[model samples]
Target: MLPPELPPLPALTHAESDLVDRFLEVLDLVGRINPARSSDTYGGLRAAQALVGRAAALRDALTLMHERGESSIHATTLARALRVLDGERRAARVTLPPAGES
Candidate 1:
């Protein structure tokens, strides 16, 4: 059972549902990758970091919705998540080498 502070899963629109699905897919991919064997050079760590941030943002949005009793109002959380993702992209570009490179 979810804790009392956590929100229940609210009904999502088609597009919102798709977004959640994609978010989960990215998270799953990040989870399955082996950093030592295959993900060391392709910004995998950064991608995983970004995905984690996204998941956090999604959770925040849901929580806010619960608090506000407005499941549809998620712009603030989405904006924050986008900023985090952009930072992750920039960090990856600066810190990681191109895929297949040493």
Candidate 2:
């Protein structure tokens, strides 16, 4: 059985690409820190510490986009890129597990 091909990622400017990368990094860290999902406090603490820097990077990416006159977010295009990069699964990890599953 063959897996279906993923859709091609939408074209993005340097700043937009950076923004998406930074945003995903932040999401990963947040997922790690999610108390409902995390098994160890120390690991969550580490993720929380790394989150401060990842968040700053995310802010920098957004600031660069604004400074470069990328005035509006192209949500539809960005959503495609995120989907290609598995953002849905990554984002889902930030939520609590289903009842009786955890």
Candidate 3:
């Protein structure tokens, strides 16, 4: 049996998965930059900080939507389940209301 605190893990739709994968690739790029390279001009450190910070924000938002009984809004993209609520027409689709505000 699953714990009550664990809101269901909705599988990411193809587009959602693609976006997350792209973000991971960007994160990989951010991680591969050499320490010295990041310190060069053009505010590299600040730019990296922005990227990491924004990614963290996105992660947090997705986590909240999936776990806690809160808004279904993702960082920028709504989940497949939510899109189903908007009457997505397809052969197969996931469907569910958010934790609250039915």
Candidate 4:
């Protein structure tokens, strides 16, 4: 079953709200396919890579929002979350077998 929608964050503009929603959706998928949490090895690795890509996309979106004068508070909070997801991506990469070793 799909998880419930997250409550809206404080002080977000309409455009920021949409970006946050997309970021959360990608994060939810990352959580589900996390290697430590899920037993499907190869699948987890693939999902981790996808997560990394999504997180990078989110970072770009957040940067654009900030450039367009979104609140610093919101930008900082989302940037922190993106960093956490990047850490997860790194850990997942470490768990994967070296290229040509699998």
Candidate 5:
């Protein structure tokens, strides 16, 4: 039997797409840099260095959107996009584990 179909992603402008992609890149790097969860100092250091560029790219994406007059964020739609991209699980990695867990 086939698996259930996933919902289509919401329509987004080019800038919105760039923003989401850049944000996810930053989120993944942050997760990698979480010292509480990471064991390798070198790896964490690498991730920390990469984060600077990813953050700048994220800023550039937002700046492009602003320059293009996309002033209002469609939160509901963006949240859906994030969910579809496994952002909830990715974001969880950056947080401290619940008390008594980690």
Candidate 6:
């Protein structure tokens, strides 16, 4: 189910509506794909379709999850840590400066 924060489809921004529509398409495709097919050909097709559906969630989540700045900040923090580990602490700190300071 979609979060309550989501508004009506027509009112959604381009990215939001696209994700919502893609999610719905994946859901419908999942219904049509039979995961337990006896034939190898059919089984492969179903498995691929299932994997596609799974991937769609992450794709949709990319922008949807960043609806607010909290997750974006978390991402920045993680990226900074990764950069620090890679010996780019100065760059990371510059990219993600301390929250309050100019």
Name the best candidate (by TM-score). Answer: 2
* Model 6 C-alpha lDDT per residue in residues 1-102, reported as the tens digit of each score: 864452222333444444444544454444334333223566557746676766667486655657743253343534433333332422232243456744
Best-matching candidate per lDDT: 2
Can you tell me which runs of candidate 2 are displaced by over 4 Å? 1-4
What is the overall TM-score of model 5 with all chains considered together?
Answer: 0.92
Model 4, 19-51: lDDT tens digits are 765676576667667554666778777777788
Candidate 4 at 54: error in angstroms?
A: 0.5
Expressed as tens digits, the lDDT of each residue in 1-102 for candidate 1 is 864453334555445544554555454545434353344655676666677767776676556556655546465554444344443443343344667866
lDDT score, candidate 5, position 40: 90
The TM-score of candidate 2 is 0.93
What are the runs in model 3 whose C-alpha is more than 4 Å off?
1-22, 25-29, 36-43, 68-102
Q: What is the TM-score of each candidate against the true structure?
A: 0.34, 0.93, 0.31, 0.51, 0.92, 0.36
Q: Which structure is stronger by lDDT: 1 or 2?
A: 2
Those runs of model 5 whose alpha carbons end farther than 4 Å from true positions after fitting are 1-4
How big is the positional error of residue 41 in model 5, measured in Å on the Cα after superposition? 0.7
In model 6, the runs with Cα more than 4 Å from the true position are 1-9, 34-47, 50-54, 57-61, 64-102
Q: What is the C-alpha lDDT of each candidate?
A: 0.52, 0.95, 0.47, 0.63, 0.93, 0.46
Clashes of 5: 0
User: 19-99 in candidate 2: lDDT tens per residue?
Assistant: 999999999999999999989999999999999999999999999999999999999999999999999999999988999
Model 1 misplacement above 4 A:
1-11, 14-22, 25-42, 68-102
Clashing pairs in 1: none
Q: Candidate 6, residue 13: CA error in Å?
A: 0.8
Q: lDDT of candidate 2 vs native?
A: 0.95
Candidate 6 lDDT at 91 equals 29
Please report, as a residue range, the 10-residue window in candidate 5 with the lowest summed lDDT.
3-12
Clashing residue pairs in candidate 2 are none
Lowest lDDT block of 10, candidate 6? 85-94
